[model samples]
Target: MKKGIRRFGGYKFCFVAAVLAGIAFVIPAAWAEDGVTDSEVVIGQCAALEGPAAGLGTGMNVGMKACLDEVNAKGGVNGRKIKFIASNDGYEPDKTVDCTLNMIENEKVFALAGYVGTPTAKAALPIVQEMKVPLVGLYTGAGLLRNPVSRYIINIRASYDDETEALVERIVSDLGIKDIAVFYQDDSFGLAGLSGTEKALKKRGLKLAGMGTFARNTEAVKGGLASIMAAKPGAVVMVGPYKPIAAFVKEAKAAGFNPVLATISFVGTENLIKESGDAANGIIISQVVPSPDDTSIPVVRDFQAALKKSFPNEAPSYGRLEGYVTARVLATALEKAGAALTREGLIDAIESMSNADIGGMSVSFSKDNHQGLNKVYMTQVGGGKAKPVAKVARP
Candidate 1:
């Protein structure tokens, strides 16, 4: 009887030990990493997916998904498929905050990517900082995102200062136009562009010939147009979304007030053409990404192929091409991070890149610098399309 009791006690002890061992092993696996699993990595985006600026957000999302889908088809990055979650903020700052919070806190995204506008980015930046989430490839060139260089934020495009400086140089050198005015949305985005234009003009010992402002997300540009018209400036630098800018252009043209109209890359080229019709012709636009139709460049060719394979019916645009480049860069960083897949590891991998060539475009990042791709291409709208231009001439 004592022998039987000893055998039973030994069995119970072994069972308890086995259970404890199993729990110990499961704990580490359960808490391996946030937004990362054995099979997948999750990314998030908050942008104006619907509204006047919907074209920018939707185009970017489509491009990113296309790249990610292609990567997944080819066994993914280091054996993990990327899952992208996009939330719409309608280009509104308040909605951007909500979308960003929901993505970080609820969706548990590993990183944020392809965010659209300057005001929206400003709104969500505090949350990103507080949560210490890495935000990659914002579309805005606002200096606020690039100035202090937060460790958690990464920019894949040129700055507004860069674009503005290029515009000023071309306008002054090629067109010999010194009487320049600004028509901009009255928000952080507009102010950022305004500041950039101001700095660029000041470098040449010049100032704005005139300035006009309109409310954000609205087509109420008549008053601003009147203000700009009153100044009778030779060239006008416009900073706003497609809708208001289109309205301003149509109204100004109707009033027979035609001058050199130039805008930054943030203005969706295709959408602006669609909205402005013939009025868009001869308008100058600065582009951060090469023309999607320019398949000569290796990266542009790859983007075209990926876009065609993934989205057969969708046409490529600068916004979508930018998105594709952003995803490719992020994917390269993710692959460099290896299978460990931690946020910090990913950041380190990105910072380690030195003039890394992703297809054709050269992108570089470091501990001191987070902005990549300083080159800006200039395009002119003609025959309902924006094409690369060597110089800016009078309309």
Candidate 2:
């Protein structure tokens, strides 16, 4: 009888241990999906934080953190605070891939946000797809990110195609200028803008008067300048970051080859102005967001307040404002996803935002459409400041 009782007790103990072990395995799997925890969600950013394009990345990070901090201060979304981690890629494609891999494999981020450049974003896309991680609000409007619409990538700004269309329209219609030329970086980002320009000009029964190219992350605009100068275009559509574009503008002005200079929104306006000094004056720039100085817009007002609260010394900028807007859109989707957050749930929530009003901006998404805002605004540099251009005229 004693031997039989001991055997029964041992059997029961083994069964209970097995059950507890199974529960232990299931609990972690249920809670730790990607970077989610009971009280926090982790998001990562890989951008040019320490190079010539550092302004773009740092501004975006500041804006995103400001908005996230505001959300967390208000008790977070669905009782979970967002913990953002940013890594620098120096706007290099190879570094971007490495940073993205680390973020997903090591840091285990829930999603990626505020990526800086087109080339960088292009490099990270394959990894994003393979890992099934969502990338929201990248800072490029390249057609590749929008066309065919990857389930893992979300864009918040108007496409380069859209911005270039607006620019070409104004260059031809408002300015009544023809014989347009292009000065672009010799890379994915510049090529995307060049393609957009070609498409827009083709619609108007016109072709590029001249074309010139420069390598990425370097200010080698002399060769490109000479090529475009020879064409003597009435208006030149410059494509690249602020530093290179600024260098080109200054060199062109110094050489007395000034034409009506115009650029897409990717050329950070304030930084361009600073880099080119007075040379930036009379230059036209397409803007994806409203003038950061325009506080009349409800979203602008909120962005300004949030920025001041979080980054006390920082001033308003288009790049930072875009980051703020992207964060707001992402937060809205998180709220819609509810407490049981998963990667698919977050993506579904983002798609469900159809004509959704984020403060004053209208963002829309669907299963077939992932690009959010399509509106483009025009601005011009004058007196070292970028002001809204209500009317376009030949300079």
Candidate 3:
């Protein structure tokens, strides 16, 4: 899969813990492959800060450190100043290969941002392609890291074949329903949402009325609620994380085996409605980004007035607004990678962002696409919260 490291696989780091909560300060290595200087630049993450997907690694490190503290309070990006660092691979892939080789051979970090899981990013995908670095904003779409397209992995969101083709077009044309089933999470991010809902149900000629699994950070969802309630499928979907799909939707509605569950936005939406309280209400998720309470979209109203003036009551979510639009698309590819940054000029300035508009949704990447955003919104789960799904399909 593109040169070596098998594109994305293999994990064998023996020990290496201690980073999250300890924060980072290490800057020893000066043979900088490109985390720059003349101010700062270093980046790093290695997610899952302490177990059962610590709320998707502290809501993607509090939205990538509150958008890198609002781009170092506006004096950064292009002028540098980014440091970051984080580590705790509690989502574990051999401790995310020793926290990506101690943040690229000992805190040298030039790039790699907002990482979450997909078997802890397939063990840091052969160490970010043998130290070439530049893995921005990845939270896992897992087609072996956007299908062999690892120039340094910059994927934004939307994939799992664009959230299972917008969740099979609103579960077969606005919930008309098709005996769907699939409980997932046995690996590779629930077999890539069970191969994107079996290729969006074989493009509608339909399929998959049953399939189940579990085993990842285990709550051991009773054999996926006895193989999706012995194929009683009227709709199931769920694919992993969020404490085994909120313990397989609270043991499939206390063994009554309800349906129309649906999921994926890599689960964890408010940790599956605060751990399936009312069995996470009506379920159904599938966003890429946008609608952290819409906020009329101006970058989710500047991510809800800077996350309520920096966490003062922090609530706007969708995992910290997709980590504040992946740190505003990594500060717009390090301010278009000028100021002489490297790591292949921030992966050619995020593959020369073609669609670019980061205020009300729009992000692109090229060199034949690194999947910045294919779109896909769709949300649900009433009173317990998590809105959105009205006209849906935003991409």
Kindly report the root-mean-square deviation of model 1 from the true structure over all alpha carbons: 10.5
Tens-place lDDT digits, model 2, residues 1-395: 22322332456758856876777666664274779998999999999999999988998899899899989999999999999999999999989988988898789899999999999999888778756799999999999998889999999999999999999999899878878999999999999999999999999999989999999999999999999988889999999999999999989999998689999988888888899998999999999999888988999998999999999999999989999998999988988989999888999999999989988889999998999999999998778888898777665
Whole-structure CA lDDT of model 3: 0.79
Mark the regions of model 2 whose C-alpha exceeds 4 Å error after superposition. 1-25, 28-32
For candidate 1, the per-residue lDDT at 246 reads: 94
Candidate 3 lDDT by residue in tens digits, 337-391 = 7876768877887898888898967887897678888878788877788788664
Question: Which prediction has the highest TM-score against the true structure?
Answer: 2
Which whole-number lDDT from 0 to 100 does residue 111 have in model 1? 91
Which whole-number lDDT from 0 to 100 does residue 258 have in model 1? 93
lDDT of 1 by residue, 166-207 (tens): 998989999999999999999999999999999999999999
TM-score of 3: 0.34
Clashes of 2: 0
Indicate whether candidate 1 or candidate 2 has the larger TM-score.
2
Q: Which has the higher TM-score value, candidate number 1 or candidate number 3? A: 1
Question: Candidate 1, which ten residues in sequence have the lowest lDDT sum?
Answer: 1-10
TM-score of each: 0.92, 0.93, 0.34
What local lDDT score does residue 306 receive in model 3, on the 0 to 100 scale? Answer: 76
Model 1 residue runs over 4 Å out of place are: 1-31
